[model samples]
Target: MEVPVMFTLQQFVDAPPSEVVRAFTEPEPFAAWFVAEGFRTPADRVRIDVRPGGQIAAVFVGDAEVPFTLHFGALDLPHHVELRFDDPAEEITVNLTELPDGRTQLDYRSVGLTDEQQAPIKPGVATMLTHLAAYFS
Candidate 1:
């Protein structure tokens, strides 16, 4: 059996948990910050149905247009969300914790893949998290 590879990228957003969650769950804010450097997710292609088994689908426009969809797994308002990507067969969890200073600590985790599977994804996720943090700055 192959070992499951897990990686977590954390960022401190200068906003409340609700806003941080909105940046991941809402279409407009999601499209703005949920992309890697030099890539854009078209707002028109983003469909955010925030329910279990629902989906957030969008096309990443870059050198090539890649269409991807993240299926919703579980949702705890302003706190936790679980999303699964079909092609890569990865489960992503977003956890938001409100700090004492009122900012939100966002933990984005990806699991259920091999190290090789996650190698290319880690950098893009890191870049996306940086953009998300800057969105609130």
Candidate 2:
């Protein structure tokens, strides 16, 4: 069997699971955290059927307007969502956990992709997590 590629990132947000989930799921709210400040980017499109085989697309509104699409391969409500990105060979798994003290921990892993040409993600993710923490604080 071919093994999938993996990408890992963990972030602890001040918000509860319910609020964090909303921030991640709802387009406008999700943009506040997922996209960078002064980005002038719009969540061009974020559609989720919230079911297996659902489709999603996010187009960053910038000078380049880069876009990404994914097909939801699996989903477990308020817990995890698995999707295959534009690259069929890759899979992204996102997990969420409720921590004590009304905090939420989000763990993201991607299998089947190479970051050889891209900036390493760990530090970048940490930066984004910091943005999220501040945004939700």
Candidate 3:
């Protein structure tokens, strides 16, 4: 059993919450910054319904293609999102708030992760933030 590991990441981007949130909700922006080192999302990626009860779909790269399914659970408009990654027994909740200077503050908290399981991804958040910085720049 994986023990819950409470982890939080905060990022301040040079864009309004609305635009940053839109980039997250849109498929093109998602695939570009969401890619981890070991995973690959297709170029033809398209996000289906992003509202509650919608499915986030993607196909892995190469011949050994594996499909992905993430379900949008709760959505609080241009502020928060709750979802679950189908292949993993995990839940995801992301929150965003607009700063006074047109900057967006993204905060994420994650649980249910084993040390070994999260070891590799410990650096992934930083990698992702770097991409987000470039993206919002």
| Residue pairs clashing, model 1 | none
Query: After superposing candidate 3, which stretches have Cα over 4 Å from the reference?
Result: 62-64
Q: Which candidate wins on TM-score? A: 1
For model 2, how does the per-residue alpha-carbon lDDT over 1-137 read when each residue is reduced to its tens digit? 44445668888888787777665566666566566433433544665455688766677666566666667777775777777766545676778798988888988776765565124544555566676667678
Q: What is the Å distance of residue 121 in model 2 from its true position?
A: 4.4
Q: Hey, what RMSD does candidate 1 come out at?
A: 1.4
Worst 10 residues of 1 by lDDT: 30-39
| Residue 39 lDDT (model 1) | 75
- Screening candidate 3 with a backbone cut-off below 3 angstroms (N, C-alpha, C), the clashing residue pairs are none
Off by over 4 Å in 1: none
For residue 31, give model 2's deviation from the true position in Å: 1.6
Error of 2 at 16 (Å): 1.7
Q: After superposition, how far is residue 137 of candidate 1 from its true place, in Å?
A: 2.0
- How far out, in Å, is residue 40 in model 1? 1.0
The digit string of per-residue lDDT tens for model 3 on 11-58 reads: 788887777776557777666666667776664865657888897787
lDDT of 3 at 113: 65
